[model samples]
Target chain A: MLKIKNLFLKKDNFILGKISFEIEKNSYCVILGKTGSGKTMLLESIAGIQNPEGNLYFDGKDISNISPNKRDFGFVYQDFALFPNMSVEKNIKFSARYKKIEDEKNLFLDLIEFLQIKDILKRDIKYLSGGEKQRVAIARAIYSRPKLLLLDEPLSAVDPTFRNSIMKSLKEIVQRYNTTIIHVTHNFREASYLADKIAVMLDGQILQIGDAKDVLNSPSSIEVAKFLGFKNIFSTKILGFEQKNKFFSIDPNKIDFLKEKCLDDYCFECKIEKIMGITDHYKIFATVKDTQSFFAKIPKQIFMELKLNEGDKSYIFINKKDVVFI
Target chain B: MKDKSFLIVFLFLGSIIVLFLMVPIMNLFYSVGVNNIFETLQDKETYESIFLTLKSSFFAVLFVCFTGIPLAYLIARYNFWGKSILESLLDIPVMVPHTAAGIALLISFNHGYIGDFLSFIGLEFIDTTIGIISAMMFLSAPFLINGAKEGFKKVDIKYEHVAQTLGASKLSVFLSISLPNAKNDILNGALMMWSRGLGEFGAVVIIAYHPMVAPVLIYDKFNNFGLKFSAPVAASMILVSICLFLSIRYINNKV
Candidate 1:
């Protein structure tokens, strides 16, 4: 396990605010944030590339003063960061040599085979494609068998199709090595797919931390909810609780779509504004009472059967359990 | 179709500039026949001057490479107090006239302060080969440093970080990655510095008048003997510089 406590790193005019977190052994933690939210800085601190003004511990040992080479953590940067002067095989072997490992050639060959870069072993780094370079970088990082892995936007620079395959490969590598990973990204889909726990950061502060689904489904604040694509969030007074403070909440994905009118207390009439066909479902947008707009996803077959169109009027029955108050 | 008038105007101006630059050197070569060139090659003074110039300039380039590369890397990679000041200071040698550079060297190395202290310890700079190397180094080292720094800056720092994470020490990363990657710029800088050192006249004349380099020897020959006596040596130096410059360009292409 790795633990970071009360870390405050100041660089120029930007300050990475006091932050703390722990990564359990063999677990994948994804840090989600927008651009310039100090996600990279935090990861660099953990990797010992950027020294923070606090303590860091690995397996209950204090590592705050350890040098980057002594940290024993594999760090993969966004740009792959392969040495341009070395060939593919030499690049992978450099770290293994530094760690003074026996049977270095066999280990390097194993990694090259695992990453499927065997044919390019003799090729210079300048000749490798983007995906190949990233694979080489990953192979080099894991060559020393580091205790933890830190990846900063590993798939952000690749094509969308390549992103899926690379992420899957990375997940398999982490699992096979039983290495704890702290991955950072701004893409919600990657976070939802890879993270065992998610930490949402904004303006240098971690705004929320919880399970990925919990953070996505019920954010702690209107800003986080909006950032997570909660479309129907509102700041309003409860109908019967006049003395209570004004609260903000969102309609969850459990809200049901209605084809015809029904006598229900938890139903609201709405006009269909837009309909979008997604991979497995259709996203339906409706404006309720001309004041609130909500989005819902239904099965594509049901959507085709109903044949919903724009400007159509309908009622959406939102379950009370589906409404989250923040 | 191209406009005949504009084409004529451009070609006319270009020809004039090219002639203005090449005529003096061409006149030197024309003045020295093939027989005179062969005869001058056997002259002991001519060989000594050429050898001294090449030797001193080579040493000056070596010194610049030793000191300038690390300074460039530091400026390119790190942020520290007075970084901008240090960057501007690097241009000081380039902007100052070589005559003034020579005068500054004379004052610092003369028997007043540093010169006296150094002499007490057994090192001398006045009228020595070391003085010639120093003068050439002062006026030309900045070109090397600035060029190499720009090259290193273009390389991604993540490469070094990756090397570090791979277990390579800091020095190993520099040797294995940074030096090889910046080889082109380093070579270019060395070429510029060496060529500049060879052509340096004012500073070397002030610091070391005896054991003359090619530029100072050319000036001495012209003043004492005549243009006719200096023409062969000047042509020889120009020919050698052209060959060196072309080789540098070729290497740059390969890199």
Candidate 2:
């Protein structure tokens, strides 16, 4: 288990303010955040690479001021900072040598096969392709069987096509090693697929940290909603209770009742400014209050059936209970 | 000149500079023929001075390897207080006049607290081999430190962190990751410092002139008997230096 209490770090002019969170042992935790959100900095601090001014309890020990070598945390960089001077075999051997485990060789072989990196073991690091390098990095990190595997945007440098395969490989590796992981990334898709817990970090502070579904379906604030790629959002007060999208089916009974008074509830009143779509899908861009814009995606059939056009007034209702007020 | 003939201008300027450098060495060889160089090499004093020069410079670089490498690594990796000042201090030997550096080293080694401490240990600097090595080190250390520092800077700190996380100790990470990665740069720096130490006359002459290095001997011979007597010794020294330099370059490039 890893517990960070009121972690504070001041790097250059950016301050990672009083961030606090925890992850259970052998669980997959993804600190989901945008770039420059101090995600990498926080990881370094936990890995003991950076001296953080806060309490870091790992497996019931206070490791706030310990050095990185003693932390026994496996950290993978985005660039895969593999030892270029050492060939693949040497790199893995160099790391595994420290374990001096009786079964290190067997364990290494298992990881190589599981991560699908056995083919590149004899090649120099420079000779390996980008995806190959990524696998090698992951394999090397697991070679020592680190207590907590901390990956900083591990797939950011790999080919986009290889991302899905690598994610599956990560799950297999985690299960095999039973290692606690804190994977930092900015993509929700990755979080949804990999994380047992998702921590939404924005502007240097974790705004919300919960189950992946909880954080995604109900983001705490507008900033987080936007970060999660949410559009067509108006004030909870202006949107009545209904998790409705312009796309797909709309309940006629609910639509008629949504047109009724929902003053105290969250409902959005807007004028359609423009419509954009081809084929079955349509995007309705609308003006809410003077300058604020809200966009929704609906089916082209719905647009034609309703005879919707520019300047048409519309309303998107959000159920009061579902309206997340931050 | 037009851009089309830029190569002509570049080649012409490069040839002039190359010729300017080679002409003097060529003149030295012509002045002292191979027979004269062999005759100078046969002289015990000429051989001994050249040997002493190589020996002192070698020890000086050895000392640089021990002290300078760690200091360079620290400067490259950490941001402690006075880091910028310490970095600037490493360049002091290169920036100051060689004679001024000799004078500064002289007082520090010959008198005061440090000099007394050394003497207490029976390591006097005045007219001693230790003095020659110390003077050479003082004049040439910047080359090693600056070179190693540049190499260390180019090595990403991420590798060090990864190595540490892989259950390697700090020293082990440095040896296994940082040192090997920066080996070429550090060796280049060591070579530069070694060559610079070979040519150090101003500092070594003041501290220990009795056990003369090659450059000091050449200067002394020129003062006593003019160019004719010293040219052969100078030519031999240059030949020996060029041979060692080429051999090192060959090994370095091969590696």
Q: What level of docking quality does candidate 2 show? A: medium
Q: Best-fitting candidate, measured by TM-score?
A: 2
Interface RMS deviation of candidate 2: 1.2
Summing lDDT over every window of 10 consecutive residues in candidate 1 chain B, give the lowest-scoring window: B33-42
For residues A1-326, what per-residue lDDT tens digits would candidate 2 score against the true structure? 79999999998999996988889988899999999999999999889887778899998999988888777789999898899889998887776656664478798878788877778888989888889988888888877778899999998888999999999888766678878889999988889999999999988999999998888777777677778876555543334335533122222112211233366544657677987876777776666675657556666666666677788777655454543444
lDDT of 1 by residue, A258-313 (tens): 87866654677889999888898888888887877778887878788877799999
- Candidate lDDT scores, in order, read 0.84, 0.83
lDDT of 1: 0.84
Worst 10 residues of 1 chain A by lDDT: A237-246
TM-score of chain B of each: 0.90, 0.96
Candidate 2 local lDDT, residue A19: 82
Cα error, candidate 1, residue A145 (Å): 1.8
Question: In DockQ terms, which candidate is top?
Answer: 1
lDDT of 1 by residue, B93-154 (tens): 99998989999998998769798997888777778999999999999999899889988888
Candidate 1 regions exceeding 4 Å error are A235-265, A269-290, A296-314, A324-326, B1-20, B248-255
